[model samples]
Target: MKIKDFPHAGETPPFGAGGSGVGLYIHIPFCKQACHYCDFHFSTSLKKKNELVDALCQEMILRKDEIPGPLQTIYFGGGTPSLLEAEELAQIFKTIDSHFEVNPDAEITLEANPDDLTEAKLKMLAASRINRLSIGVQSFFEEDLKLMNRAHNAIEAVTCLELAKNYFDNISIDLIYGMPDMSDARWQENLDKTLALDIPHISSYALTVEPNTALQKFIEKGVVKPVDDAVAQGHFEILIERMQQAGFENYEFSNFGKPGYYSQNNTAYWTGKSYLGIGPSAHSYDGETRSWNVNSNPKYIKAIQSGELPIERETLSVTDKYNEYVMTGLRTIWGISLIKIEESFGLKFKEYALQQAQKHIEEHLLFLDQDRIVVTQKGKFLSDGLASDLFLINLS
Candidate 1:
């Protein structure tokens, strides 16, 4: 199932209407090479790297008052943030410091590819105050890597993890299951490497071929075999069982972590906390309105240089907010809080949610627990579908 296919799920507001504890997301839209499955905005060529960086800093300065005091998390996600030199990272951080009040213990994460995490780079990262690393080790097998057109090979994947663990204890690695050629054994081997690495957190997703992506074309032309939904479901079940056995909490649909190791940045998003997303194609939400920067690099840089925000805005309706609450809340271990629904969206919305969830509860897909609607183990793999099924269609 497509993760982004949830009906009625869009720009969701935070827990309370005016909630303020904020997170900062910096989108570095440059990758060394494009992955077949990736649809996120990015550029393969870094011809305007300096100008883009300057634009990012300017955006931060321009939008400093978007969110209130004490930024709780700072996430650097993108084509490959690890590609940036240490000095560049520091320059961006310096800009953020000048404009925002970053908590001393805030979670600062950099999304890095396996090949870029060299020994010297790790040391520089450790010194740069980036306390966490989210490595894109999509698979531990060479075959899978080649199929996805990843920049790093299987050997580099393993080697980098070994090196990264020494410098940073708070690390998360991403792995993909449900590839066209992935067998049960290969899926197990990927998990085996993950567990062997003693990594505290893991985020895994089923391989989805988005429209216009290479994988989609390959399947259309019969160049590559199509992914099996049943097989993907099986892989997910295996992942849940294995992670539970290893003492990791399935905090969110695709994330498993050892208690405190949960991704604070992502959790903020799932829990509906306000955040300021900077750079190209980045999204930002403050309680009532959600906005996004221009997706094109040249347009975004030009707009920023011209002293315009280069963003689009959407003011969420009350119905829209409640629908979002149902969508994001059900995807996490925290589930949907009935009290929150009643308090934030009103009793009518809460009653509507309960009425809609009745069928799923009877089907054993979802259950009520101390006022929270939670997905049962049997329904975890189908959470997105189930959530959409429970969404309120009326916005009035």
Candidate 2:
């Protein structure tokens, strides 16, 4: 289907009005070990962990006023935040409290690796204001864990869940599908075991062969089979059908949550809400333009210590804004709303979007529920391609 040809006549809007309230993403780039498929900026060494934490706290303190609202959502993502000592994390939180305006009921989340989870640590995290724990339990199968070089085994993954559940009521588990050797039956078994836990949220993602990763190298050498698109599609279908049948709403392409359990932090991003990202390799978006820190941890530390921002930024164009909304919205239950397209971009773009979306609707690849143009079940996997097709040209 052809998308409407809309012109950005003028450039897109800048990020914020004196930095209106923004979500915070604090990246922790240290880990016990690096997974074969992981390309995210992280290191396995603990030598500089404490120093990095101090730097991060300082970074937050320096950038506090840049965010206008008391922090609504604080997400600790990356190099295995669960690896930090609970007290260390608490120190960082205290620093944030000192400089920033954090709401009393802020939805604080920590990304945890299964092997790093412990009963004591869970207690410490709970005692702090961290209300949610998103565990990295990539797969429930022992073979899958070994293939991915995960530090935690199947038993450890399962045990971590049980332990985490005892302390944190708001728990989300991350699972992977369509791995090189992950069979359809095994995938189903993983789903069954996950459903048994009855987690409040589930983030399931299909394995992709990203560049420069060990998985990509393995495929090049024939050490591991290349990813099977057919197999991935099959598993995704199972994921959607099973999760929906289990009463889990497909909130995002890779996320499922029970009623009232959607991830507010992530939702903010999808809905064009402003957010601040701190630490090495983190990216921050403020409704319009986006900025990111240097990927090198040592470099980030050096820059911050010199009293500099330690980042590079890009201004958003009208095309960039429109395309971002299309890309993110199509991946969620909200889809793309004509009203939002109009309000955010302008009325001219809105009229063009609705006119263009009619083609996809007729092709049965998209659903038109009044003002909302949503992707159909068959179109979910092709969401990226479809969104790209509808993008406004000349982003630069």
- Pick the lDDT winner: 1
In model 1, the worst 10-residue window by lDDT is: 1-10
Worst 10 contiguous positions by lDDT, candidate 2: 5-14
Give the lDDT of residue 69 in candidate 2. 79
lDDT of 1 at 62: 92
Clashes of each: 1, 2
CA deviation > 4 Å runs, candidate 1:
1-20
TM-score of 2: 0.92
lDDT for each of the candidates? Answer: 0.87, 0.82
Clashing pairs in 1: 14-272
Query: What are the per-residue Cα lDDT tens digits for candidate 1 across 190-249?
Result: 998899999999999999989999999999999999989999999999999899899898
